[model samples]
Target: MLSQKDEWVVEELVPIREKVYQYLKNEILKGELKTGERLVERELADKLKISRTPIREALLRLESQGFVTTVPRKGVIVSQISLEQVLEVFSILSSLEVLAVQLATERLDEFMTKELDELIEETNRLLAGNEDEEISQFHIRINNFLYKAAKSPRLYEMLSDLVDYIRAFAHIGYEVPGRMREALHEHKDILQAMSERQIDKAMKMTQDHIENSRKAYIRTIDSVKKK
Candidate 1:
């Protein structure tokens, strides 16, 4: 785990409350702040070198977003995501992302196609090197481009929220044998379909990719529980 001390430092430009919210949210998504971990307001404020007001506000926001919950005796703690919640989020994400892929394939211009090709090449390089973190970041960049090509702000926001909820488990899935290479191939298939202007093929591939991801996450979780 990285230093919490370093994680608390906020940039000067963003509002302290917003920054705190984003920081905590990112921490939760990254699994640095594990499920059921208590988030003490005073402790957070002290660590962040800020007043408790922003910490409280950030906690409230996190709670509303299902990232944390208020326990009767525990105060605020990171939320434990259930399998049902994971299934629900991933199902919606798959449907929305398929739509996004369809729109992007239709809307892709020459420049966007070139960019996707470049990203695919980068992903291939990262895959060959077995750079899991870099590959994950590249995958995110590719999805962000797809979302941008979709031209739907509301859709993007919805997809982002869904992705954030399950993102913590993504690395765990990557740890499964051969999962990284398989995911890279899946990504390539989707991108190839989109680049070829095969809208239906792209949409189907996107749905399949997300479904496989969901299954991988569940398998990882089950393996951990058995251990």
Candidate 2:
């Protein structure tokens, strides 16, 4: 995972407490706060120039989100992301993405296709750096577009939260050789099918795209364990 703490803490676009949560969660997801690392509230409060109440509240919320855990004496520690948990999350992700893409296909037009082409080009540039987490932002953007076009706000909301969980591990796939480029091509193919009004083909491509991503991420983790 790439560094996100600096980005999350900037300019105060959101509420103060929410900004604190975003900054800490960004640190956790980017592997800056390693699994089992105890989080110091006083230090965090001082670092962010806030009081302890909001920090405590943010930790509790992060705990509820499964990104951190309150240990017996270790306070809040970043949670471990297991392979089984990854599998479960990706299974849901694949299903929802396939549905969203299929629905989006029905709403496709020249304008949206042009927009997707632009997004694909942007992703291609990001892939040059192999910035998986940044590329995943585009993933979320595409999903939001698809869900909105699908007229499924609730589904998008669900996906929005689920995406946080997946982003924690998005970097793993990009570490594998050529995976970023392949993922970009997959997005292009899905968009092409959608533009052509081929719902069946788009759906199939979506499924294949997500499933391949999951496999790639898991394969990388397995290889690391072996090493």
Candidate 3:
């Protein structure tokens, strides 16, 4: 059962299904809900203090996104996606984000460049101070900048869906050695190019940035396999 604070955070008045899904998704990503663990719908409903209908809806949605699976007589379990599947999702993400950054580059203006400069500076500060907890949040901030500048709804939706499929195991890249330094440098370089209106350079750098993350995750997988 979730604690009182967590329960409060999970339940919302509108769009209850998305809240439920996000709650469970966070659980899986943070390893609170382990891989292959059964998702007993009734227990989740009782724990969340909600009716089973929304829980069912969330589970079905997660299943379609490849986050969970329904088994015969075994109930629902977090899907243990293979390494190949992980790479495939990352490949899709790289392509989608490449397109996003390209569009964002084309639309870059002085105002947006200033906004990006501030972001990169703050990101650098966090990295220098070793603000580990803010790593994911920092990445989100950068991605949001590109996402907004890109101004493509359908592309964003597709990228988000592909991300959800592999998010449960996303810690792999973060756990890799020297990932923070590498990723931070990548962000700085990519943004510098974008701010200078070097669209082609920015596009290639963004592709390399995402591809580096994919490679880091693969290394993490290989290490785990050896153990």
Candidate 2 vs candidate 3: the TM-score winner is 3
lDDT for position 49 in model 1: 78
Tell me the TM-score of each prediction against the true structure.
0.89, 0.81, 0.89
Q: Model 3's lDDT to the true fold?
A: 0.81
Q: Which runs of model 2 end up more than 4 angstroms from their true locations?
A: 1-13, 109-114, 120-144
Query: Which pairs, if any, clash in model 1?
Result: none
Q: What is the C-alpha lDDT of each candidate?
A: 0.83, 0.78, 0.81
Q: Which lDDT tens digits does candidate 1 get at residues 1-227?
A: 33456555566777778988888998988778998999999998877778899999999988887889999987999997788887888888899999999988888888888998997787678777967777777767877888888888998887777777767534577777888778888988888888789998889889889888888888988999999
Question: In candidate 2, what are the lDDT values of residues 39-137, reduced to their tens digit?
Answer: 899987766666888789899888887888888867788887778987888899889988888777787667777886777677567767866667666
Report the lDDT of model 3 for residue 186: 89
Better of 1 and 2 by lDDT: 1
**Lowest summed-lDDT stretch of 10 residues in model 2?**
1-10
TM-score of 1: 0.89
- Sort the candidates on lDDT, descending order: 1, 3, 2
